[model samples]
Structures are given as C-alpha cells and as structure tokens.
Target: MALQSLQITALTAMRARDVSRPSREQQEAADRRPLRDETPRRDQPHRGRDR
Candidate 1:
C-alpha cells in the first residue's frame, strides 16, 4: 500500500510538471524577447539624457 501510494504520488508529480513545463517555456521566451525590446525602449531616454 505504501509503494502504491508512492507510485501514485510520482505520477501526479510528473503530470504537474508536464502541465507547468510549457508555461515555463513560454515565460522564458517572453522574458528573452521582451527584455531586449524593453531595454532599448527604456535606454532611449537615458541615451537622450546623456547627449
């Protein structure tokens, strides 16, 4: 019974990981793209100030 419960727990953990994995990948992609996009836009004013 303990072994069975352990197996069930493992399966549930795997399912949860699988569900979250895609959203994690999407967040990583958004972070990469938006970081670059936002940096330039934010830097524009700073650059202007320096000039």
Candidate 2:
C-alpha cells in the first residue's frame, strides 16, 4: 500500500504548477514566443541575361 505522505494526486499537482506560475496571460505570451534565433535570408533574384 502507498504511504499517505508520499501520495500525490493529479489535481493537486496541476494546481501547484498553476499557482506557482506568473499571471496566466504572461505565461501564455512567453510560451508563444519563438525559439529560433534568426531566420535564413531569402535567396536574391539573379540578373537576367543582357539583351
């Protein structure tokens, strides 16, 4: 049998994480931010053959 003190239910775990986090809106904004450092430059068009 599991010990009472060691037991952790899913709802309590979820609530702990939710409470420790910053305001919900700011947390959401940070999560949405991009991970990539820089985007690759698009290839430049080449000059057409001289007439």
- All-Cα superposition RMSD per candidate: 9.1, 11.5
RMSD over all Cα atoms, model 2? 11.5
Residues 1-51, candidate 1: write the lDDT tens digits. Answer: 676665557889999899877677788887677555466454345546765
Tens digit per residue, CA lDDT, model 2, 5-50: 6977899999999888799899799778865665566687667845
Tell me how candidate 2 scores on lDDT. 0.80
Top candidate when judged by TM-score against the true structure: 1
List of clashing residue pairs for candidate 2: none
Alpha-carbon lDDT, every model: 0.70, 0.80
Residue 29, model 1, lDDT: 83
Q: How far off is residue 22 in model 2, in Å?
A: 0.4
For model 1, the stretches where C-alpha displacement exceeds 4 angstroms are 1-8, 23-38, 41-51
Q: Which candidate is the best by lDDT?
A: 2
On the 0 to 100 scale, the lDDT of residue 20 in model 2 is 89
